[model samples]
Target: MGRRYDRLIGSLVGTCAAFAASPAAAATAGAPHLDGAEMGLIWVVPFVAILLSIALFPLFAPEFWHHHFGKVAAACAAAFLVPFLVVHGVSLTIYEVVHVSLLEYLPFIILLLALFTVAGGIRLRGSIIGTPAVNTGFLLFGTLLASWTGTTGAAMLLIRPVIRANEWRRYKVHTIVFFIFLVANIGGSLTPLGDPPLFLGFLKGVSFFWPTQHMFLPMVVAATVLLAVYFAIDSTLFRREAPRPSDEASEETFGIDGKINILLLAGIVGAVLLSGIWKPGIAFDIYHVQLELQGLVRDVLLLLITFLSWKLTSRENREANGFSWFPIIEVGKLFAGIFLTIIPAIAILKAGTGGALGSVVSLVTNDAGEPVDTMYFWLTGLLSSFLDNAPTYLVFFNTAGGDPAALMGPFASTLLAISAGAVFMGANTYIGNAPNFMVKAIAEERGIAMPSFFGYMLWSVGILIPIFVLITFLFFH
Candidate 1:
């Protein structure tokens, strides 16, 4: 792994230098911006390749992918950068790289790291028998907690308990799948801290409580329906299965260990809120990407919070929780490539009527140039199912007109559609959200048999799709 990582880094550095010295680098210093309208569909190959590598590689080549996924991600990024350099020149390539790194990837990974670290430190000390009612309670608790601790954080905190409770059950895959639906995705729709896409909206000048106010009804409806469905299914499954002999030995009471981490989790939330609310209007420009004072402060504080959790928490606490760094590392590496390769797609989407994907933009607007709420909901949700939701949300947000004030006011329904789509539809696939994969990884490690990529899609299509359709009719329409 070390050798592969080194080679990948070396290749990237060499590629950057080679492009920097090309004649086109100097010639295009002041040329007009590269028009997305002029680009062909072929430019999107690397992006597609990276997404395919993520979805297919783990299922087919688990051993090789586990060891060298980072290398694969780096290579995919280089695939985009190489051709991008040839066509757009070195300066633009460098700018885009620096821009994504500073504006998107760094802040994203930092928050995930903080949440993963802090949540991993805290362990649920007691276990319960996997009763249908108890399982429903856990799902409900996680759904509410997700809006506060983050979907990733809440999923990490509760998944182990859920798995342990159901370890002896023969039909438990459904439990884990529903956990992913509510805890890992849909439950995060109500707050910026709940999901990265909403946090990006907050950074773009949307108010901190805007999601809470606008998304409350949709979130409540989704969570209630999922919980009710889960309870009914679990009750039926419980009746068909015999009780485990060891179930009697497990404790009925629940308690939390590593309590300090709760304070740290709160600190993580406070840090995020502070960054959004305490902006001093100070910023430093690095390669045309603006790093704001509050953002830098927030990143530093998050790092400190992560470090303190690592230092203060007992090793036993983490071990009991089955904590490892691999999940976050996987997310960090894969999303780095995602953030890089997505540049062209976002640019093309931003080009509106002039780009190759102009039809997509046209689909969400009416003949009179008005944004259609249902189209915004489904289009944003569908794209977010395949692409990373944060950038997908940004694309549609801009498509709906990127004014925070307007989005919060007269265009509030459109903003709500975009938010609900990005957050809820992320459950449509395992790769839709970062924690979805992490939860699957941890479950598989605990000896639970998770579904394959397409198998999981079947669950989403049967369950979540109908719920979304209802949402479209009830709210979006």
Candidate 2:
């Protein structure tokens, strides 16, 4: 009789334990599908836009047909294409958490301010270096400079000079492709501010110093390889253009008269600092209010800065440089298609997390059967070359968190993969990096014929991919 009663009590406790565990496992299960849904939208929107733009761009601007349309148009098409599809397809969960509110939009505004400041700074100096021998120098210097001034600043400062130097050359496409690889992509590996992924890591628990210190060797190696490779390719192209009579006259000095634009730029930076220091309080009820206030002030200041930069700069300088709103306008025209198309894909990623992903995501095991964190940085880096590096970084960034024990692994090694992958792989295609589009637009505005979308990838897949694999093996593994 006593044994029977004890068995009844044991069964009751087991039932209660099962009930408690069920809710947690259930919550974890629902997360992955939701993630997939969210990411799926990113892909869908851009694809639709690609179809629409093929019809729309020519209809709207028939004159665009007469000059080289394939380069800029294909690039713009990609700016709308790759990021939208890849982000939509990844099934990341972060967006799901912030989906209901405007806080998710905060980063976009920050990017806008940051990008504008970068653009404004570019407008000031234009390009300082000319090419062939100096082209590789610009690439190396720009990569180092990216760590401090931001990749956008480095890209903007160097692009014009590179373009001008190669302006007389027929084979300018290789120059821009290498520029995207080094200046736009691998250059940002050192700092959080340098790349969005490291910045996101900063917002999480990772230290700023950690990534920079660990990444230095790889950065130096990659920069050196890229410079050597760029010089070789550039030399070959240079010889081809050289046999023909040089139509281009070298400019002695190109000077800027608009110094006040610098002050306006300082104001934009000040606005960002102000917002950071005076973050709004977030109560459950009023969470978005703070984000709204900060965003409004940030954007308003950007508007003022844009106006002042335009107003203070001399008209002759603008025309002499052939400066127009075309670059910005081009960026604006193309990203709308990207933004609209990727929304649904992100939804799918959010909806499908954990439920469908468990089989696909697992640890690498040693011969002894000890589990290790999978080498995600490799594939994530590769995918980033095709997708928008930011969302690609986020999806894998979250995925790397599975076993708490994994954090005990080398911080430098792990974050190196994540940071390096995101920054470096951005050069995989023209659209992989934000500055790639801006640089391409700037080049085309100056009348250089850049490559088509696939053409740019051919350069990357052929040259950059092998270098990245060497990097991963030498350092990351």
Candidate 3:
């Protein structure tokens, strides 16, 4: 499957090159500005196709998908690029590719890679049982750590231990699902370091502690509710499952190997902060995309840290942790396609009332042009659930008027809604955030029977949706 997909990609690339070199195609050389208002909804077919591929392919054709998933991603990217190049010309196509790759995809993948590699090196060497109290404590610790180490970092670091602790239990799927909800998603709402959306907000002139100030109560309420609910469900499941002979000796010892990786994790966090704070303003232009010095420095440092972690940690540590590269690789390939196909969708949303999706823009505004906070909450969240949350947050942040001072002041609730929606609702689906997929991959690799894509949505819709509704009235409204 992999080879077949590679051949198809090669053929597509050859065709594109030949077409571009043709006299007629060469004549259409200049870049044309794209107006989302003029674009028909049909342009979104590739995006929808890619999304469906992510959702349905795994369920319908497991073997084919497992092998050729990257190829499917590449095909979906080409589906958009080919027509896009024909319509918008070579210059704009090049710009779009470079723009998304340099500005969005590279940094995103690098951060995740660093976190995954560093966290994978750390193994908790302990004989802890997965009692209800122990499980709840692990979840709570992960939830707190997420704000500091990032959702990806925290999830990667703790997921293995959680799975190991509960390896004896038969009904343990709920524990993993709740882990996705709380540790991988909601737990990252407190600080800019917690989630990508908030970090993007920070880079867009929001203060470092702004999210802490605005999102604290909502985050506390959401996490507390989730933790309480998870405890109840897990306790019941625990009672149903018969205890193993090993469970008779309840006392257990706990220690951590690969402790140096914890410092590397801190280095990762510091590197991110340095990029935001120490902007040198120097940039190199690559095909019209500006690669800033600070960002490049951060990426390089992250790579270095990843290498150091790999070299320092023993092979036994990774083996014990059940660490593998498949999870990160899967995330990297799938998101490459997602970032590319999402370009037009973002442009349409950016076009506001003038764009193809004007009605969507209108949903957050009342007849008097007043910003409706509740609508902002739901719309931003619903979109973030499908679209990548960081960019979605930025879109609504700009839509609500992009002045940080204004947003933090008069439109405080609006900003809060956008922040909460992007971070909180990312739990709604597997692809809603990067870590969500990584956690799912790791859990499945550990032999846990994860739900189908739609099955997981049922869990989110049933659990998270109601909590969000309550939040809408209690806060955003």
Candidate 4:
């Protein structure tokens, strides 16, 4: 244990030391940034390693994973940073690290933490049966709720209730899988409030109602198909399982405890909306990274909300809900690794036809450079299924010509492709979006084996890919 602790500390020190070596170099001439055009494919290996680690370790080495997953995360982060430090030197490395940590990672985790805390406090009290109708209704409600409260908010709020509803069922993995599909991912397509990527678009001058106007049809198609399919699978499983005597015998009433948290969830939505709408036009410069006043306000407000929710709810309040901080901690640590290591990948993709993945960039256009909406959809989606969907959306948004009016008018279909791809295909993997991981963790905590990472992909690849293909034919093509 001591050695493991020492190793973890070493990993942390190594990663941090590189970034800290030259704080005063923020104004270094030439801007000292990573030229993704010069970087090769090797820079992305660390990101791939972490993905494989998350997928394989739990399945093949559960004991080691449960014991030292944080250390593994730290080591993977170091593997990326230490090498980049050697190649780029401390100045550029520090700039890139601070850039992402402050502007991207911090905001990402803060929003998630706020939603998780507030949602965890809202305990649904009842012996809701695991009947097909009940489970389907829960998912439908969560899907509708996601676009308003945020996917993290919706998923965190109802995952426990949904799990509690189905605890008695033997064939229940399918329910959680479909919940991820419709509720956590596809459901977030209606507005910027729905998901981080859409919110990023909102910040980038995409109109508030743009997603609602354009993405509504695609979101409806995906949700309706998945919900219907989930209902059928669950119904068949419901009939196959041996019915317990108390399944229908108990006349349990449904109710909610810690009802105040319902209001806090709304506060969360307001705080996020305020960040987008109530821009105060002030800024803070943290080591050359620009921090806007509205952003800081949103983050602080969210933290305060999280604290209030914790204090307002009693210990028993959350205990009854089976709410634990483990899921959030697990997501925070693993995503810290994911975000840090993915720096190069985002940079490379952002470089367009000059980076190592130029062939990928070239695919979205033809010899005449016309925007092929179909390729935009598939590429953005396939990349988003692995990379952080927010930046992936930004990359393709810029690729489609970053002028909002033009994209919203002349290139409307192209913008729709990018938006739908990022928002919907996030359901393609547990790591594809923040909420997916949280939902998986919470479900597993309730003793659902869920699926192994690749095992889960089997579900996504078999189920979601076809849906996306159908969407392509119906819309993008």
The candidate that wins on lDDT is 1
lDDT of 3 by residue, 52-136 (tens): 6765565467678779888998999999999999988888788777766776667666776777688778777667789889999
Per-model CA lDDT versus the true structure:
0.76, 0.52, 0.74, 0.73
Q: What lDDT score is found at residue 113 in candidate 1?
A: 78
The CA lDDT at 383 in model 1 is 72
Best by TM-score: 1
Q: In what order do the candidates fall by lDDT, top score first?
A: 1, 3, 4, 2
Clash pairs detected, candidate 1: none
- TM-score of each candidate? 0.87, 0.64, 0.83, 0.82
lDDT of each residue in 1-477, candidate 1, tens digit only: 121111110001000111111111122234225566777777767777876776556657777887888899899889888899998998778777776676566777787778778877988867687899989999999999888877877887899889888888898999999998999888887777788788767756677789999899999998899999999999999999986885357655789988999999899888988987785877776665566788799999999999999999999889887677766667678778877876776667667778887887899989998889999999888877765566678678767766777889998999999999988998898767666766777788788899988899999999999999999999988
Candidate 4: segments with Cα more than 4 A from true spot: 1-31, 163-173, 199-209, 233-248, 383-412, 429-462
Candidate 3 segments whose C-alpha is farther than 4 A from its true place: 1-33, 169-171, 199-208, 236-252, 383-409, 429-431, 434-459
- On the 0 to 100 scale, the lDDT of residue 80 in model 3 is 92
On TM-score, the stronger of 3 and 4 is 3
RMSD of each: 6.2, 14.8, 7.1, 6.0
RMSD of 4: 6.0
CA displacement after TM-score superposition, residue 287 of candidate 4 (Å)? 2.9
14, model 2: CA deviation in Å? Answer: 48
* Model 4 Cα lDDT, one tens digit per residue, 109-171: 677677667776886767778799999899999999888767766776688778877777799
| TM-score attained by model 1 | 0.87
